[model samples]
Target chain A: MINRHKNLREKKGNFWEERLGLRAIINFLRQKKVPLSEHTIWLYTGSLILLFLAVQVITGIVLALYYKPTVAEAHASVRRIMTEIPLGWIIRSVHFWSATGMIATVFVHMISIWLLKSYRRPRELTWMTGVFLLIITLGFGFSGYLLPWDSLSLAATKVGTDIPRVIPLIGGWISKFLRGGEDVGADTLTRFYLFHICLLPLMIFLLIGFHIFLIQKLGISHPLKYEMRGIKVPEIPFWPDFVLREARVWLIALGVLITVAIFFPRSLGPQADLMAPTPAGIKPEWYFLFLFQTLKLFPSQIIFISGETLAILIILLFLGLFFFLPLIDNQPARKKGKIITAISVIIIIYAIAMTIWSLFE
Target chain B: MKFKYSCLSRRRFLSWLGGGWLATFVCSLIYPLFKAITPPYREPDEVVLLIKEVIELQPNSVKYFSWGIKPGILKRNDDGQLIAFVGVCTHLDCNVQYLPEKRKFFCACHEGWYDENGLNIAGPPPKPLRRLFVYEESDHLIIRREEKA
Candidate 1:
């Protein structure tokens, strides 16, 4: 009887082990923490991104239940949710505000690493993966903007899709593919919906997995001062130090988001009327406001090519430079230089100028 | 061992308590703020319309009139009896305009068509025209603005 009891206890232990997988992972993390590295900070950042992504996905799915894809019904359905469905406006507000907040957080996270010179040798792949993630984040915003099918969304989409039309050889084809037709209509909404909810999401998931994997493989980048110490600093455990800090940041973010959602829920405007002339002062989401305003500054025509074409060329050149930035600065500098500083300053000025122009002009 | 592990530092406990309180306070503040921004709900009310005395609604003619922010149209048929219908089309709720020459209420949205009696004649409308309660009062036509049964 005693022998039988011992076997039963062993079986119970195995069952418990399978059920507490997180505990096992946490134990492993605890064991792996090095003594002197700032692993805690990177872990916190990663955790916060994960938490925000969770919020985005959950709120997005809820909003999707009531969202209509057709232009005719889309605006009405959104309005219905605001007025009829219980807490629907709050859900939508959370999704919208969270999306904007996530983009801001990701940008800050990227710039912080860059300023800290953490994107150095042996971490180029990490930086590249991050850039890809940034692209996907922007993709999320662009596709999401059209779901409401408001007049502003419609006009912005028209201006946005035109950017690809300026590509030298395949610009027109790219624009056509993106718009799914010659003009913005049901087809455009369907295509954007698919990209936003399906294709880009899959790509983002894969890239995020790869990003985390690369980070783990390379280990957290040590502070600049620690690089010359000959001995690598040991990392702290992710649990109590990192996760706890992350929870605080997340709580703060949630507080701010809820406040914004409550005070300023997403706007609903007059339903989109295609036959009606486009309204004045139509602008894209704040993130794209700068680009929208940029397109407006160009003259109606540019050297026989349309003004839109010239604008597209300029944007493409800018994107090309952005993607190839690592290759441009071949020097092994630890801090900012004249060239880097100049580029950074120019970008800041451009962003500010476009924002101001969007508001005034 | 579990008891020892469960115990938190005083500093950590204080911070957690402070954070929790702050979050609750902010959440409470937000609830009222959301209520303040939402538009006040107004009950749909009955509208009394004067059919003949106020407007010239002729035979085979339709006249659009507003009833307390809700628009309704009065149409006089060949028999000279006035028939009233909500101006908003059943399809996507765009206001329909009476094309006097065409003798039909035409919705610009997707080219929806409704006849003289406001019946859905063409397009993707799933239902017929929504009729309002109409009665002649004091030599005038009045329409109750409640939703059609």
Candidate 2:
């Protein structure tokens, strides 16, 4: 019976191969290899991000079934989901945790790839696409934050959306456009809702698909040290070996996500009140704290220009330098690469310091 | 020669397929962005601008409030009529404030000024402040920007 089953499977495989070149595709995948190194731990961050995104998508879909986007119904629907729907709180909590996890892991993955010089040579497009993915992920966070329509989120959204009004030209229009007129009202809610769930997902799906295709085509980049030494390194096949290793990471990430979701379910704040003054100490999300702190350092005006505008532009320029690193330093040099690594380290340290200080402040 | 021809044709077929998919996806993505930027303009059910407690506000007092999505001002005139205008200055679009003592609206950004009736009174304001049509209920004021002629 086992021999007969094998024969049947062989026949089916042959049928697909004959029509669709299935065997060729499988062979290509089998031949793919990822280098084994101490840096393998960093490699896991990519898969960790993917795992969190999967969790986010699944839980987000489930939550959306019950979540309302209108200001009047949004808070109430969230409350009902937490208190009434079976396991809805866990689902929502998991989604929240997964979003934070995705952002953290994606940021780390980008920096790792940047430090590793993975954005070099044939992978320039890959680097640009990754930058875009990071932007979209932040967009996801910003848009999703207001879904609950809680007072804290509403105030944060108001301040967050208002930041763009400081830009030189078209600034006011940009803010008004984002809020769907003048303020965060029903129009703003619907816009953010559509952005978080629909437009962003569509963009991310396309970008991620292309990103993966580029990585698969280019293969992962060797560490700069190995390249500098011109040393031969060992590698493991992508399927069954590299893939199985990623599964282990996914399992660990899932465990932590579930543990957090179960132990500390997400909080629902009070309903939004437009008339009341914003509650004090209204800090933005952790990822944005660095920028928020930076903005605070600027004066109201800078030599006839809006100081906030100038500060934001400078920050944008700093980020743009990182985004275009591949093009900036193509044909990599050890000295330049080291400088970049040092800068990345400093940025990370500065970000952590700013986040903690903002919390205390 | 025949093999080369077949290879070219196969590659062309794949190109066509990929291009078709790309075009469809691009159109789908761009549509929503257009939708999002263009705010929906459904006619409001009742264009009432109830500022709550018309009598409580002393006459000649300017009450600043939101008229729907726009910042608005409602002043209880000495004659007991409530006059309303959009709070945005006609120049630079900076928010204007009412200096009731001066009986004028002021824009601090560039020194633009308007009279209590929303006519530009001084300082680089090329146009008058936009007037809003409003009616008074027993204790509230109603604004109808699109009030019929």
True contacts kept of each: 0.00, 0.00
Q: What is the DockQ for all candidates, taken in turn?
A: 0.04, 0.01
Error of 2 at A105 (Å): 0.4
Candidate 1, A150-203: lDDT as tens digits: 887887788788778667888789889989988888899889988988899899
Worst 10 residues of 2 chain A by lDDT: A329-338
Under the 3 Å rule for N, CA and C atoms, how many clashes does model 2 have? Answer: 1
Question: What fraction of the true interface contacts does model 2 reproduce?
Answer: 0.00
Interface RMSD of each: 8.1, 13.4
lDDT of 1: 0.75
Which CAPRI category fits model 1?
A: incorrect
- Number of the predicted model whose lDDT against the real structure is largest: 2
Best by DockQ: 1
List chain B TM-scores, each candidate.
Answer: 0.69, 0.68
lDDT of each residue in B1-149, candidate 2, tens digit only? 35644545777889989889868855753453333333234433235544555557777788777666667887778887887777888888889998889988899999998887889989999999877777666655667776656
Query: Could you tell me which residue pairs clash in candidate 2?
Result: B49-B142
lDDT of 2 by residue, A1-361 (tens): 9999999999886886768887776677779988999888898988788888877887787778778888789999889778766667777888899999999999889878877788888889999999999999999999999999888889989988998887778879989987999988888998999999999999999999999999888888888788778986789988778888897788678778878988998999899887888988888888888888888889998898878889878877888997888987675766676677788779878878888888789
